[model samples]
Target: MKITLPGSKETLPVGKILCIGRNYAKHAAEMQSDVPGEPMVFLKPSTAIVRSGGVVVLPKQSKDVHHEVELVAVIGKGGRNIPEDEALHHVSAYAAGLDMTARDIQSKAKANRHPWSVAKGFDTFAPLGPLTPADQVGDPQQMEVSVTVNEETRQNGRTADMIFSVAYLVHYTSTIFTLEPGDLIYTGTPDGVGPVEDGDVAEARVSGCAPLRVRMSRELD
Candidate 1:
C-alpha cells in the first residue's frame, strides 16, 4: 500500500515492515522476556499495513489481540551496511505505528520455538500514520510515543528509553539486509501493552507526528 507523506503530494510505495522485539527493558520484563544484547529483527510483509485512519479487524485466528504502539522510521535512501553516523541520512520521515499481535498465537509459538510470523503478520495488523519529514522531527531518539484505547491511556513512552537507538537500529539492520526506501522500521513499543476487544478505538502517536487512529472490529466468517 502507498503511504501519505506529510506536506507532500507524493505517495510512498511500501516495501517491507521491519520490526524489533523487546527493545525496551521495562516492556521486555513485562512480557516475561529478556532484553536482547543486540537488536532483535523481524519482518512483517507489506500486506499487513493498514494506513492511517483505517480499521484493524480482530482476526478470527486468535482469541486475544493486543496493541503495541511504536515509532516508525521511514527509510528514504537505500543502502547496505550503513554507517552508524550516517544511518539517519537514510530516513526521510517518521510516523506512529501499531504492531498489532495475536497474543495467544504468539505465546503458543514461543513455547514451541516456532516463528512468530503467523502470530504477528496478519492482514491489517500494522497500522501507520502519515509520515513527518525527518527535518521537522529533530532528534527522534527523544520523541514520545503513546497510545490511548477508548479514551484511556494504555501505553506511554519516550524514545530515550529505547534499548537500541533509531540510528543504531538502522545501521544494524542494514548490515543484515539492504535498507530500501519505503521500508519501515518499527523501533519498538513501550511497557504498557494489553489486549483489545472489538469496538475499541486505539490511537497511536509519535511526538511531532500525526496520530494514527484505528478501531477494532471482529473478522466475521
Candidate 2:
C-alpha cells in the first residue's frame, strides 16, 4: 500500500508494520499483563492501514473492539543491527496512529497461546495521520499522546511513559528483521483504552503532528 505525506508530491510504499506491545506500564496493568523485561513485539499487515479521516469497519467476529492511540515512527532508511544512538537517523517522519484491536479475539488468542495477528491484522485496524518530518518532531519522548472518542478524552499520556523508547525499539527490531524504507513502528499505547461503539469518531494525536481522526462502523451483512 502507498501513503501520501503532506507537502510531498511523492507517495511512500508501505512495508511490514512492526508494532510494540505492552510498552507502557499503565496500559499493561490495565490489560492485566505483566511488564516485559524487553520490548514485546507484534506485526500488522500493510492492509490494516486506514489513512486519517477514514472509517474503521468493525469486524463481525468481534464483540469488543478497543482503541489504542500511539506514536508512530516512519522509517526512511534501512539497516540491520543498528545502534540505539543512531536509530533516530533512520526515521523519516512521525505520525499519530491508532492500533485498533478486537479485544475479545485477542483475549481468546492469548488464552490459547496463539499469535495476535488475527486479532490485530484486520483491514482498517490501523489508522494513521499525515507524517511530520523527523526533523520537525522535537524530542519524541517528550511529546504528549492522546485519544478521544466522540469528543470525550479516552487516553491522555506522554511518550515519556514508554517502557521502551522509540530509538531502542528500532535498534532491537532491526536485529530480527531488516529495517526498510517505508516500514512503520507503532510505539505502543498508554492506559485508558476502551470499546468504541458504531459511529464513534476516534481521534488520536501526538504533539507536533497532525491528528488522526476516524469513525467506527459495524460490518454490513
Candidate 3:
C-alpha cells in the first residue's frame, strides 16, 4: 500500500462515546417516539468508531437503517459535577458525527423492553471525523448539521432547536460519569431520518465544524 499523505504522529483519542437521543421533539415524532423528559444517553464501544472518509459496514442483523446527524463535543479534561456555566472550559473541540442506527433492531428492542446496544453499538455505527481543535469552533450553539444519502438530503438540524443545550449535557453527563480526556459527547440528532441501501454514499456535515461521510457496504455471504 502506498501512502499518499504524510501521517502525523498524533495518537487518536480513546475515550467514552456518549450519545444523546430524541433531544429534538420533531425527530422523536418522525419515528413515533415520545419526547423524553431528559437526555437519552447511550454508549458506543470504542471499537465501533471509524474516521472521516471511511467505509461504514451495515450490520448483518439489521434490515431498516437510518442516519442521525449530530454535533460532537470532544472533552479535553476530566471532571464530575461540572456546572453548566463552566462546561465549555472542559471542551476541546467540536465536530460532526452520525448515530447510524439499525432501525429494525432498535424498534424490536423497544417492543421487547431491551437495551439499545445491539441496535446502536454494532461495528462502524458511529462514523465521525475531520477533527477541529476546540479553539476553532466559534459558536457551538448555532451550527447546522445535515445528512445526505445518495445525494438526497435526509436530515438538516440546527443546534438552536435543542431542548437541552450543550452546556447542560456536559453538566449532567459528567455529574454521573467522570468525563476524561478524549471523551466524546454526541449532542443528539434532528428530525428527518431514513434508510440507506448497499452502495449508497452518505455525506453529513456540521456547518463550521467537521464533515461526516461514509461508504455503505454489506458483508458478503
C-alpha TM-score for every candidate: 0.97, 0.97, 0.93
**Residue 124 miss distance in model 3 (angstroms):** 0.6
Evaluate model 2: give its lDDT.
Answer: 0.94
Winner by lDDT: 2
lDDT of 3 by residue, 93-142 (tens): 78788888999999899999999998998888888866676667777888
lDDT score of residue 196 within candidate 2: 96
Clashes of each: 0, 0, 0
Per-residue C-alpha lDDT of model 1 across residues 80-152, encoded as one tens digit per residue = 9999999998998999999999999999999999999999999999998878899999998899999999999
User: In model 3, what lDDT does residue 81 have?
Assistant: 98
Better of 1 and 3 by lDDT: 1
lDDT of 2 by residue, 32-122 (tens): 9999999999999999999998999999999899999999999888999999999999988999999999999999999999999999999
Candidate with more favorable, higher lDDT: 2 or 3: 2
The 10 consecutive residues of candidate 1 with the worst lDDT sum are 3-12
Candidate 1 vs candidate 2: which has greater lDDT?
2
Q: Candidate 3 — which residues are off by over 4 angstroms?
A: 1-12
- RMSD (Cα, Å) for all candidates, in order, is 1.2, 1.2, 3.5
Runs in model 1 deviating more than 4 A are 4-10
